[model samples]
Target chain A: MLNIIWPVFIIISFMYAIVTGRVNEVNNGIFEAVSDAVELSITFLGTICLWNGIMEIVKKTTLIQKLTKLLNPLVKVLFPDLKHSQKAKEEISMNMVANLLGLGNAATPLGLKAMKTMQEENCKKDTLSNAMAMFIVLNTASLQLIPTNVIAIRTSLNSANPTQIILPVWGATIIAAVVGVLATKLITKKIK
Target chain B: MVNYISAAAIPFIILGIIIYGLIEKNKVYDSFLEGAKEGIEIVFKMFPTLVGIFLAVGALRSSGVIELIVKIVEPMTKMLSIPSEIMPLALLRPISGSASMAVAVDIMKNYGVDTFVGLITSTIMGSTETTFYTIAIYTSAVGIKKTRGILVAALLADFAGMIASVIIWRIMSTSFC
Candidate 1:
């Protein structure tokens, strides 16, 4: 995955550059141009570690168990196969929570972990099962309540009312998120 | 690295491990070590994706392409009744924070940071993502096969937020700040 990530990034970047006439800059300072690859792990380490701890606590306390119990019936409609696993249910909810806070930085690994975890039981080996499709849909159409990271960036840059866009952002996230899950559920069901 | 974030997490983690060990009849420390080992692998996998996306954003700013986009978008920006002065930040706000920060600083240097333009640009900043960077990294990490609907919806969301920031600031300034 790491190997694939960079190659894909390079190709996308190269295409963007060529289209935007940034190819000239790349040729001139190839090293300088590629400077962003420098801190591949250090900064995200802090957030990842922090969120991982949060996730661990959430799982340990059975907040996840309770949460799964609550979301399960609704989830049964969207992800009928995942109707029962405490672990899978916890992972999905946490991943969704991270997205709600606009923690893309954190939500990502959790989402990936959930994907791998779901694959572990090997029950969905035959096809793109409801649970698998539901996860993909949820991750893509995550509902954000706070837009925390974006708000932080705005405030740091001196915006007068960083919270100004809160409502619209929330509205969009909710709509997309609900639509995303339901649409995927329906689409997958029809295909099956 | 794990020590700090795990500090508050220690109590829960220790409890979880102990419970697991007792249930499964294994050593608590052994279970914990296994968890830590798995955590490290997860972080390592995220590397090149984050690095490449951030770098590409840096390049966009340095190359002045972002500024050009801002200029092109300025008229539609004004039509929305948003201050045209914020056009740069409106465009940059979604792509990169540091770059947008510098641009905001430049706007502040010219407009005195407390003015409507500065305030609104900053507000817009607080409200958006580094769009391309997020799309690149997140979609890659999650692997979305089809992005058309997501792309259109996200951009519309961004546009809605951008407009909302301006209107809110305008109303807020006249009434509150």
Candidate 2:
């Protein structure tokens, strides 16, 4: 997917800029983009380490199992074939918890962990499993409870009610998630 | 109260996890160090993908391509009663997180945050995910090359979120104000 989109982005940008005489702007954008990515990586480093560390401790105790138990019904529905992959189920549960808490930093690392575990016993090397596809859809739909970052930005901008959008956001995400799950399930069945 | 809860959430979760680990007689410190090391490795592995995505997204944004697309889609969006101010945002939200945030912030600055546009922007920002970034990282980390169905489903979901945001906020702004 990225293999196609990434190149198309570069090609179209250059083509459009050349046609529209915005070549310099495109050049500057490309030049500064790597540094921007590096800066973001640096910012993510501390938070990622902190959350990963905490998650490790959680894994060591029974907390992971408890959390997994709490999320079991949802996880089972999402990845029913993962009945034997207990580790994958646990990581998926952890990732879901992190996402619901609106912890983007924590969620990525936990999600990567989930993906790694799911890949451990895969017979296919390059193709995604049904469970993996469903998991990615769940992440993409983003069923976050409290959008802390959005509220913070609104507060900074002096909004009268920074949290007023929460209810609407919940409505949007729930609908998005349902659509995503249905779409994935449809595609999975059709493909199989 | 919302602000207070958001601020305290992380600290409370961390403290609770630590105390639980201690009660379980687990090697919390050692486990943390190990996990932290893995985090560093994961970041390094993701760096190349990040750079590629950021470069493409940056170029796309700066080339006026999005504005061009918005202009093309203006009539359709207008018919749907979606504001033109948020078209770029709807386009960028799934591509890049920071770009969408910048656009959302710009919208709020131009129009007050309580306005319909601002409200919809915030709702969209909160609900939608960066589908490209998340899918790329997750699939690449696991060495999954055939990401055929995932991208389609994810982008569809983002579209749903964007439309849902606009409709909900429209109803909300009308009823509340």
Cα RMSD of all models vs. native, in order, equals: 10.1, 6.5
DockQ score for model 2? 0.47
Flag clash pairs in model 2: none
Top model number, DockQ: 2
Residue-wise C-alpha lDDT for candidate 2, range B1-177, written one tens digit per residue: 544554566567779879988999988899999878876876676667667766776787789886777788889998988888788678778887765665576567657888888989999999998999999999999899987577898999999988899998788667765
Lowest summed-lDDT stretch of 10 residues in model 2 chain A? A59-68
Q: For each candidate, what's the DockQ?
A: 0.10, 0.47
lDDT of 2 by residue, A1-192 (tens): 446766897899999999999999998988787886676567556655665677777666765446657998899888988999989988999898878766576689999999999898777879888999999999999888767667656766768777777778899999999999999998888774
lDDT of each residue in B54-147, candidate 1, tens digit only = 4544455445555666688778766788776666566655555445554554454356555777656655554555555555554454444444
TM-score to native of every candidate shown: 0.46, 0.68
- DockQ, candidate 1, vs. native dimer: 0.10
Off-target runs (Cα >4 Å) in candidate 2 are A1-67, B1-72
